[model samples]
Target: MRLTALLASLALAGCATQAAAPPQPAPKPAPVRAGLDPSFELDAFPSTYRPASSEPVAIVNATILTAAGPRIDAGVLLIRDGKVAAVGRDVAVPAGVHVIDARGRWVTPGIIDPHSHIGVGSSPGEANGDGSNESGPNAAGIWVEHAVWPQDPMFERALAAGVTTTMILPGSANLFNGRTVTLKTVPALSPQAMKVPGAPYGLKIACGENPTGGGPGKPGTRAGGMLGYRTTFAAAAAYADQVREYRRKKDAGQPAQPPRRDLALETVAAALEGRAKVHIHCYRADEMLQMIDLSHEFGFKIAAFHHALEAFKIAPVLAREGIPVVTWAGDWSGYKMEAYDSVMENAAFVQAAGGMAAMHSDNVMLMQHLNHEAARAMTAGNEAGLRVTPEDAIRWLTLNPARILGIDGQTGSLEPGKAADVVLWSADPFSVYSQPDLVFVDGALMHDRARPPERPRSDFELGAQRRPEASR
Candidate 1:
C-alpha cells in the first residue's frame, strides 16, 4: 500500500511539473507569394479582403446587362461562394437563397475604372496630395500601392458610382511613373486589404510632352524622351541578363554571386519580360505611333494609352496592335496642342475600328459619373451615324476597363466563375437621374442606398458635415 501511494504521488508530481513548464511557440508559417521570382515576391502582403456575404443570393426580375453578352430582359442573376454562379433569363433560383426583387429595376456588372489616382493622389492643392514625382525622370522603383491611402474619401464616392474595381496609378510626372495597383472599391483600413487578388501589375510609361521639361540633361524633345527610354531599358536588360545567369549557374550546382538588385531596373526588367502590362499616358497620334515604335524597340508591349486625344486618328493602328485606348468621354478641346484633337467620338471611333475603348475619368469629379460619361460618348457616336448600343456603352464602363487591367476573367462581367461584383440600379444605368440602389463586391452587399450607414466615410471626413465653428 505504501509503494502504491508513492507511485501515484510520483505520477501526480510529474503531471504537475509538465503543466508548470512554459509552452513551446508554434513554428512560423511559410510566406505566401505569387511566384518564386524574388523580384516579384518581397513579402507576404496578403489581402485581408473578407467577403461580406458567402451565402447564395439571387437578384431576380431585372433588366440585366451581362457586359460580356447580350442584355436579358426580366433576367435572374445568381451568386454563390463569392462568385457569379449563373446569370441569364433562364437562371433558376435555388431554395434557401436570399432573393432581391428587382421588378422595376436594372442590374449590371459593376463599373471598372481603367485609369485613376484616387488613393495615391489624396487631395488637390495639398502638399502631400501627389503620389510620387521625386527628383528623377526615372522613378520606377516605387509602387503606387505603397503610396495608397485606403481611407481616401474618393473611394467611397467611386463606390457610390458603381465603381467596383479601379486601377490606381502614379501620376505621369516621370518617364516611368511606377507600378499601378488594382483594388476592390471596398472600405478597408489598409491598401493590401483592398488589393484585387491575382491582378497583374501595371507599369506606367509616358510619351510626348509630359516627360520633357526643356531643361539641361532633361528629355526636352520627343527624340530625347526616346533616347532616355532606350538607355534605361538597355541597362535594365543587362541587369536581367546577369540575374538570369546567376540563377542558371546556381541551379547547375556552381557557386555564383547573385547580381545586386536595382528596384528601378527590376521594374523595367519585368516590363521587358511581359510580366507587367504597359500603360502609356499619350495624347497625340504621332506620339502614340512613336511610343509604339519605342515599345517594339524595347520588345515590350503597350497594353493601353490613357487620355489619347488623337486616338481616333490611330484607331485602326491600335486595333491591329491589340492595344486598348482609355480616354475621356467628352472632356476635351483647347487645353493644349496635344489636347486640341480630342473628340467626343474618340471612344466610339475606336470601338467601331475593332479596338477596345474605355471611358476613363482622369479627374476625381469625372470618375463618379463614368456611366454618364459613357452615355455622352454613346450619344455622340449615334448622332454621328455610328451604331453604338447601350450594351456596347456599358461594356466601355465595365469589360473594356477590366480587360485593360487584365482582370476580365475575374470581376468585369456577369459570368459564371467570375467574382460577383454587381450593381442594382433604380433606373436605366445611363440615365442621369439613376443611382445605384445596391452595390455588391465579391457577393457581399457593400452598399445599400436604403441604409445610409452602409455608405462609409473616411477617417478624415468624420464629422465633416457639421459646422466647423460649432465643433471648435
Candidate 2:
C-alpha cells in the first residue's frame, strides 16, 4: 500500500512537471500571408463583409485623379461606410465628418497589383515548394488561397507604397498552375478575412516557354505548354458540361445524376460562364496571340497577359482584342529562348498602340514600389517619344489593373461612390523623391509616416525581425 501510494505520487509529480514546463511554446507561429495559402484563415468571408463606420472621412484640397479625366484641382473627397461618398470641388464639409488637410497632396485610387506572391511563406524553400511551380507539367487543381499568410509584412509595406489590392497566384511552373485569390491588405488572421469583397475569381494560366521549365523537349518545350493548356481546358469543358446537364435535370424535376466534383474544372467553368477572370502568364508576343485564340475557343475573356516581355510587338492586336498587358517596365531579362526579343520600349510601344498596359510586380520585395515601376515605364515611354504623361502613368498602377481585376467601378479611382482607397503623395508621383505620405484603404487610415501600427510583421514572417524604424 505504501509503495502504491508513492508510485501514484511520483506519477502525479512527473505529469505536473511536464505539463508546467510550457510545452515547447507550440513552435513560433509563422507570419500570415495573403494569396493562395490556406492555413492563414483568410477564407472566412462569413457570408458578407461591410466596411461601415459611424463617422465620415474627409480629405480636402488634394489633387485627385479620376482615372478617366483631367485631374481635379482643389478636390475634396468624402468617405462614408468605407466607400467614397462624394468628390468634387464643390462638396460641402459635413459637420460631424473627420477631415484631413491635403492642401498639396496627390490622391488617387490605391495602387492595384495584378500579380504578386505576397502573404505566403515563400521562403525556407522546402516548406513552401508547394506554393510555387517547379513541379510537374500541370497542377491546375492546386488552389493558392490555401497558402496565403494574412500577416505578411509585405501587406504593410505595400500599404505604405499605396498598394491596397492585389492578386496572389501560384508560380507559373505548370501550364494551369492554380486559381488566384484577390486580397485586400488588412489585418485578417485568416485568408477569408482578407478577400476583396465582391471581387471576381480568377484562374492562373501560362503559355510560351514558362511552363516548359525554360528547358528543352516535351512539356519542357513551348509547344508542349500550349498543348497542355488546350487539353486541360477541353477536359474542364467536358467536366463542366456533365455537371451542367445534371443541374438542368435537377431543375427540371427529373432524376439528376450526380457528377464528380473537380476544383480545377469548377474554376475553368466559372471563367466560361463569365464568373471568373483569366490572367495568363505569357512573356512572348506569339504566345500572347495563341492565348487569345484559346480564350476565343473557351468562350472567355483573357483579363491580362502577365510578364509579357514582348508585349509591345503585339500591342496593336492585343488592344484590338481588348486584352490588357500587365507587365514589367523593361524586359529585365534576355536569358530565356522566348525572352530574347524583349525590349526597353515594351511599355512605350504598348501604350502607343492604345493597348492597356499595367506595371505589375510579382516579387514580394517590389510589391510596395508599384509607383516606381510606373515611373520606370513612364521614363521608357518618354525616352521613346511615346508621350506617356505622369498622370497617364498613374493609371497603369491604378485604373488599368483595377479594370483587369474587374474592380474598376468600386475602388480604382477618385470617383464618388467608390471605396475610399486613397494615397497621398509627398511629391509628384513620377518624381524620384515622391513617397506616399498617407495611405487609406477602405476609408481607414492604414499608413501614416507620422503614426504607424503596433505590429507590422506579415503572417508569413517568422522570428523576431523588427519592423524598420524608418518604416515604423
Candidate 3:
C-alpha cells in the first residue's frame, strides 16, 4: 500500500512538472528557390596534376620489360624532367644522376587498372557511403570523382602493389550509372589532384544481372535492359538537339530561349559528342552484341566492355570492331547464370583471336595482387596452347588499359618522352612470388620498401587498433 501511494505521488509530481513547462516555438519554414538557370555553364576543366620531381635518376642493371617492345636483359632506364628519358641496354646514365643499382631486380611499367572503385565504393562497404544509384535505373548525373574520398587508404595500398594509375568508376547498379574518373594512385587532399590530367572521362553503363535489381520498374529481363539503353539514349539525343538548336539560334542573333538543362541527359550527350568514352558492364555475348547495336543506333562507340566473360565467344567480332575486353582471369563459376559461361582461358581466347584483352580486378583485395592475377591468365593461356609472352601479359595490366582510358600517349610503357610511371620488382612481375620493391610516379619515388612511404591514411585508420603484424 505504501509503495503504491508513493508511485501515485511521483506520477502526480511528473504530471505537475510537465504542466508547468513553457510552450516551445514552432520551427520556421525554409524559403523556396525559384529554379536553376538554363544559361549556366558547367566547366570542362583540365587536370592540374603536375610532376613534383625534377631530379634526374637512373635505375641500372635491371631486367626491364618495356611493354611497348622486347625485354632487355640488362637495361638502364633514365628518368629526366618527369619523363622516361631512355630505356635500353646501352642507354648511358649521365654523371651526377642519382643511380639506383638494381642488379638482379626486375623493372616494368607501373600497373594500371582500367576498372576500379577504390574511392567511390570504399572499403568496409557501406551502402550510403558508396556511390551506387538505384533510384530509377538511370543515373548519368553522378560523377565518381565527386564521390571520391581522396584519403581512402586503398589508394596507398594500390600504390604499394605497383598500381601507379587506375580508373575509378561508379558502380553498376543503374543502367547508365555515371561518369568514371581516371586517377593517379597518389595521396592528395582532393580528387582533383589525383585525377589523370587530360584523361577523357568514361560513361559507366551496365547490362545483364546487375542493373535488373528484380521486380517492377527496373529492368526485369534482358529485353528490358536493351530497351532501357535505347530509350535513354534517344531522350538524350533529343535533348542534345534542343541544346544545339538553342546555341545555334543564339549565335545567329535570333531570339531564342535555352532548354532546361538535364544533368543526366547532358552526360549521355557528352558521350554522343565523343567527349566521354563509353565503358559498359556486360557478360553474355548476345547481350554484348545488343549493346553494340544500341551504341550504333545512338552513334556513340563503346570503348570497352568490362567484365565480359562471354567475350571469348565473340572475340573476333570485338577485335574486328576495335573494341577491347576487360575481364578477370580465373574469377568465375556458379555465381550467376550470366557468369556461368566464364572460362579461365577467356583472356587467352580473346588474345588468340587478335582481340585486345585486359585483366581487371573488380575486388579491392584482388587489385593488390594484379600481377598474380596476370600470372593466372598467363598460366591458363599457356596451358591452352596460346603463345602469350610475359611482356604481352604485362601489357594487359599496363598499356592496354591505358589505351582504354585514352591516356596511352601519356604514360603506359617505359617509352621515351612518357611519364616515368615505373615499378621495380623484386623478381619477375609475372612470378607469383614477386613484389614491388619501389614504385615511381612522374619520376618521383612514391613507394619504397625500405621505409614507411609518406602517404595519407583515412581518418578511420588513423589511431586505430592494429594487429602486431600490421604494424610492420
Candidate 4:
C-alpha cells in the first residue's frame, strides 16, 4: 500500500511540473529527447549498431539447419546474452531488442573447417611463408598458433565465405609437424582477443607417404614412411619416460632434475600423455590403420584423419573404434600415389557406414564454397545410392566437424543453448548461385552484404577487397 501511495504521489508531482512549465516560443522539436536513452543517440545511420551491453538478437522467417534432422522453415533463432536461447518455428519474438529480417533465406550453423591453413601464414609466397616444413622429417613441439598472424587477409575471405569457425593448423610436410589451434574466426581489432579462449589444441602428424616421400632424404617407399612414424614415436615414448621419472623423483621430495630441452621431443611427450589431439595427414586406408596402431602403441588416441581418401574402405573399423575422418566431396585423386583411388562417394560412404565424416577445405580458394561442397556431397550420395539426407550433409559441414574440433557443445548447429554462429544464405543453399547474405558470431551480426557497412578495414586491403578486412 505504501509503494502504491508513493507511485501515485510521483505521478501527481510529474503532472504538476509539466503544467507549471511556462509555454514560450514552442521550443524546437522538444530538444529531440537526446538524453532519454543514453546508450543510443538518434543518427542518420540505417545500419544496426551493436551496443556493448547484453541484448537479444532475433532472426525471423528463415530455414534453420539444426544439423540434426529437421529443417525449420520460417524459423526463429534467438540469441540472448550472446548464446542461442531458443530456435524453432514456435519461438515467441522478444520485445525491446534488435530483429534481423531473414525472410527468404537459409540459416545454418556456421561452417567449420576441421583442417585449415587460413591464418598460420597469410601470404603463402616464397619469402614470408614458413608454415609447411619442407625441411626435415619431423619437426615436433612447435605450435603453429604462435606463428599465426591475426592480420591475415584470408580471415576476412574465410568469414565472407560463411566460415565462422576453424582449426588453424600447420602444413603436412613433417611427420609430427606441430600443434594446431582451434578458434572462432570472429573479426576483431586485436589478435590476442581474436583467439578462441580455452579451446583444445590439435597436433599435426603425417603418416604413410607425405612424411617419407616429401622430405629432403630418400623416403620414396611406403616402407620408409612406416619406419619414420614408428621411429619418431619410439623416441617420443623414451622422452616421455624421462619426463615421468623426473616428475616422480620430484614428487618423492628428491632434488628436481630438469631434462634437456628439445622442442621436437616435447611434442611427442605431450602426445604420449594424451594432452594434445593427433591429426595425422594420410590418404590411404592401410596407412590409416597403421597410424591407428601407432597411436595405440604411444598410449594416445588418433583424433581425426585428414584427407583420408580411402577412409570409406575402413568405415566399419573407424565406426567401431570411434575415430573421425576429415575429408571433402571434391578433393580426391588430385596429387599422390595414395590418392589414386579417391572416390566421389567418400564422405557419403563414411556416413553410410555409421562413421563420422566431415568436409574440410584445405585450399584457401576452395573454402569459399564450403556450402556448395556440402551440396555436392549430397548430390553425389544421392547419385551413388548411398542415401545421406540433406541434414546429414549439413551435419558434415557443421556438427561433425565441431565434434572433431572439440567444439560441438559450444558452437555448432542452431541449438537452444549454443553460440549464435550462423550463416544466412541469399537463396536456397542447394542451388549453385547462393551466397551468404550475412554471418553472425556470438550473437553479433558480423557480416551483411547489403550494408555499406560496419565491416572490417585492414591497412593493406584499404582499396583491394569488396569488404574491409579486420582481424578476428
Candidate 5:
C-alpha cells in the first residue's frame, strides 16, 4: 500500500512541473561598442630604434661634470651594457673592463638640443631640401619624423660636437606647426631608427610674428593669432569631450559611437589631455603672458618656450608656473621688432629667478656649437655678477634641455643606471678652444677625433666627394 501511494505522489509532482510557466528568454549581452580605430592611435607609428652595441669600459683620472651634482675631480666613470654603471671619485672597475686613461680630460653628459631642424631642413639648400614648414598655418596633423632625411650630414657634425640627442621640431611658420620628434644623433637610414625610444611627442605652437605673417589665409595680427589659437583649442576640447563620453559609456556596458577621428584635433586633444607636450615659440613678454593665459583658459600646460627672448621679463611667472625657457645664449636679436629687446643675460636672469633655462641651437650650424652657446651664456651671467660655474652651465647643455625634452630619466646626466651618453673634451668644455675629443652615445663610441671615419656617414657627402672639381 505504501509503494502505491509513493507512485501516485511522483505522478502529481510531474504534472505540477509540466504546468509551470514557460521560462523567460535569456537576456542579450549589451551591444558591443566599437572603440577608436587602431590606426587612429597616437602611437600608430611606433619607434623602431635600438641602441648601438656597447662594451664594458672605464675612464679614470678625469674631471667629471655629472650635471646632477657637483663636479668630481679625479673621477672614474664606468659604462656597461649601454648604461652608466658607476660614476664617482673611486668607482671600482671590473678586472676585464677596458680602462681609458683620461688624464687632463673633461667628461660630461652628452649634450641635448631642445630645439633643432637638422633632418627636416637638410643641407645643400636645394629646392626640395626643406620639409619643415607646411603650406598652411595649421599643421597639427603633420609629424616632423615622417619628413626627416636621416642622411643629413648635420647629424654627424652635431655628434662630433657632443650632441647625442636633439628634438627636431617643425618650423614655426604656423599657428600649430606640428608634432616634434626627438632623435638620437645616429647615422641611420630611417628616422624611425634614430628616434629616441619611448620619448614623448611635442606639439609646436607658434605665437607673435611668425604665425601672424606666416602666409596667405593666416592670422595677420597678434589678436588674430590669439583668436586662431582659441578657436582651434575650443574644437580640440570639444572633441576631447566626445572621446571621454564615448569611453565612459563603453565602460558602463552601453552602446556609443566613437567620435569621427580628426588627426589635427587628435594632436591638440592629446596636448589638452597632457598626453603630449606643448612647445610654444614666443618672443615678447606680453605674448608669453597671453600664452600663459591661453593655457589656463584651455586647461593645458606649456612645456617650454623656444626662442624666448623676453623670458627674463617674466622669469618669476615662468618659474611659478614651472615652465622652462629654451633660448639662445648670445645676443641673437635686432633682426625683428619682437626680438629687438633681447638681452644677453636672459638665461642668467631666468636662473636667478629660480626658473629653468637652457640653450637651444635653432640653426643647423649652431647645433654643432651648443657648448659654445652655453659658454657665452655663462660668461654673460658672470659679467652680470652672477656666479655661474662650469657645473651650473653644463646643465644648460645636458640636463636642462633634457628636462625640457622629457627624457631626463633615461639620459641627460652621468648618473648610475642612466644611458651612457657622454663626451670627453680635450680641455675645459666652456673654453672656445675646447673640442670634443671623443663622443659616446649609449656607451657606443660614435665619434673619435683621432680615428675619424674614412668615409662620410651621409650618402650626400659621398656624392659630393666624388663630384668632379669643376662641379665643385
Candidate 6:
C-alpha cells in the first residue's frame, strides 16, 4: 500500500477506536488548595554551573571594542573576582593584579553563537553518537542537554576561537524537536556543568521543507505542516484551559479533579505562558510571515528565526514585529529550494531595516571562525553601499547573539558589572591572519594559544592515538 494511504488508514483506525470507547469518569482527588501538583516540575534538570576560579588580571595597551559603543585605543581592561572591574583608557591598574601588556593586540567581548549543535551532534559522527533528533515529528518533551556529550572536542576548539557561550539546539528534522540549552564554552564532565546558570530555555520549532520532508506518518506537505502546528497548539490551548479550570476550582474550595499531565502539552503551555523562548528555523519570507501570524494567534513572542536565508526579503516586516534574524554570514544557497534566495548581505539588510541581526554557526567547522564570518558579512555590506563598521560587525558575533539567547544582561559587552568574558587577539580580529592569543570566561583564563593544552580535553581522543610499537 502507498504510504499516504497507510497513514490515512491508521488515522481512521485511531478515530474509530476513540469513538467506540465508552465515556469514563474523571479522577477526583482529595480537595487541597496548598500549591500545584508535584508532577508539574518544569526544571527537573537544573543547572549546577559555577564560574571557574579567577584572580585579578589587567590587560593593558590594547585596542578594545566593547560591542556596546565605539572602539577604545590603548585601553586597559581590569578583571576582578570574575567580573569586569573597569575598562577604558584612563583606568588605573592596581599593584596586586597580574598585568599583561597586549601591545598591538585587539580586545573585545567573547563571542556567543545563538545557534549550534556541537555536543548533541558530536564530531566523528558515529551512528550511536548522534542524538540531535528523536523518531517522531513532535518531541517537545525531550531536552537536548540530555543528549549532549560533554566530551565533544569541538567545545575546546570553539573556545580557542573565542566562543565563550553557545546554545546547543536540536536538529531541524521535526516540526517541534525539543528544548535548547545554553552553555559556556568551558571544559566539563557533564552538560549541567557547562550550562549557563539561570539562562532561559528555548523551544525549537521548524518551518518549510525540513519538518515536512519525511514521507510516512508525518506532514508530507507545507499545508499539512501548518495543519499539524495548528492542531497541536489547539490541543495545548485546551490543556492550558483544563489546568486553569482545575486550579480555579481548587482555589474556590470546591471539589476538583486534577488534570492529567501531558509532557508535550506542558512544554507548549510553557511557551504560551512566556516562560520558554520560541525559536523557529525558517528560511522563506512568506513562511516567516505566516509564522508571525501564528505567533499572534497563540499570543507568544518569537525569540529568533535561525538560518533565515531569505530574511532580507522581509527585513522591514521582521523589524516591525521585533524578531531578530540569526543567519549565516556568507551567501550559502542553492543546496535546497528554500535556501535558494540567500544573499551575502542578509545580516546587513536586517540591520539596515532597524531590526536586530546576528550570525550563527550551524556547522561545527564554521563555529571555529565566527569572527571571520562577521568580517565576510561586513565586507559584503560595505561593498553594497551600507555603512557597516567593525564595531557593528563585532556586535553580530558578541552582543547581538547574547541578546538573542536572553543573556545579554550578564555577559555580552565589556561593561563594568558584566561577567569578564573577554578575548585578546593577536592582531585585528577582523583580519584573516588574526587569532585569539588569550580567552577568558567569567575572568578565568580558559584558553591561551601561546600555551596550548598538552592533553586532549575529550576522552575519545585519549587512547585513539596510535601507540609507538616496541622495536624488536
Q: What lDDT score goes with residue 420 in model 1?
A: 94
Q: Write the per-residue lDDT of candidate 6 for residues 1-472, one digit (tens) a residue.
A: 6999999999999999999999775555675433345235457788888999999999999999999989999999999999999999999999999999999999999999999988877877632355446466777877889888888888899999999999988887788888899999898888999889889999999999988986655688889889888888888888889988877876666677777777777777778878789999999999999999999998999999999999999999999999999999748899999999898999999999999999999878899999999999999999998779999999999999999889999998999999999999999999999999999999999999989888887887766755568332
lDDT of 3 by residue, 201-250 (tens): 88999998889857545788777878888889999889888988876765
Q: Residue by residue across 1-472, what tens digits does model 5's lDDT show?
A: 9999999999999999888969665454454423344123547677888888978989999999999999999999999999999999989989999899999999999999999998888886733355446566679989989889998888999999999999988888889988999999999989999988889999999998888984686888888988999999999989888888877766665666677878888899999999899999999999999999999999999999889999999999999999999999849999998999988889998999999999999888999888999989989989999778898899999999988889999999999999999999998898889899989999999999999999999998987785566666
What clash count goes with each model? Answer: 0, 38, 0, 3, 0, 0
Ranking by TM-score: 5, 6, 1, 3, 2, 4
Candidates in order have lDDT scores of: 0.85, 0.76, 0.86, 0.76, 0.89, 0.89
Give the least accurate 10-residue stretch of model 2, judged by summed lDDT: 32-41
Q: Tell me the deviation in Å of residue 449 in model 5.
A: 0.5
Query: Could you tell me how far off, in angstroms, the CA of residue 281 lies in candidate 3 after the best superposition?
Result: 0.4
Estimate, for each residue in 2-118, the C-alpha lDDT of model 1 and write its tens digit: 999999999999999999999774443343233434334444466666666567899999999999889899999999998999998898899999999998899999999999888
TM-score of each: 0.88, 0.83, 0.88, 0.82, 0.91, 0.90
Cα RMSD (angstroms) for every candidate in the order listed:
10.2, 15.6, 18.0, 18.9, 4.0, 14.7
Q: How far off is model 3, as Cα RMSD?
A: 18.0
Whole-structure CA lDDT of model 2: 0.76
TM-score of 6: 0.90
Sliding window of 10 residues with minimal summed lDDT for model 5: 31-40
lDDT ranking, high to low: 5, 6, 3, 1, 2, 4
Per-residue lDDT of candidate 2, residues 1-472 (tens digit): 9999999999999999998996343333343233322212233333144443445788899888767667888988888877888888899988988888888887788899989887664544424544565556556667787887666666777778888888888877667777788888766677777777778778888776567766433386677777877887788778777877765655555654466566576667767777778888888787788888878887888888888898888889988998888887785787777777776668778888988888888886677677887888888778888898867888898888889898888778877678888888876776778788888888877778877665545645544566578476
lDDT by residue for model 4 (1-472), tens: 9999999999999999999998654222222233232212232112122322446888899888888659899999888977889989999987986888889888888899888887665743422465786657777766776666766767787888889888878887767788887766765544445555555667898776666665475366768767877887788788777767765654555654445656676676667777677888888898888878877766788889998999889989898878988997845685777788877788888888888999998877778888788888888888999897778888988999988878788887888788788888988776789888988888777777777354344444554555435643
lDDT of 6 at 218: 67
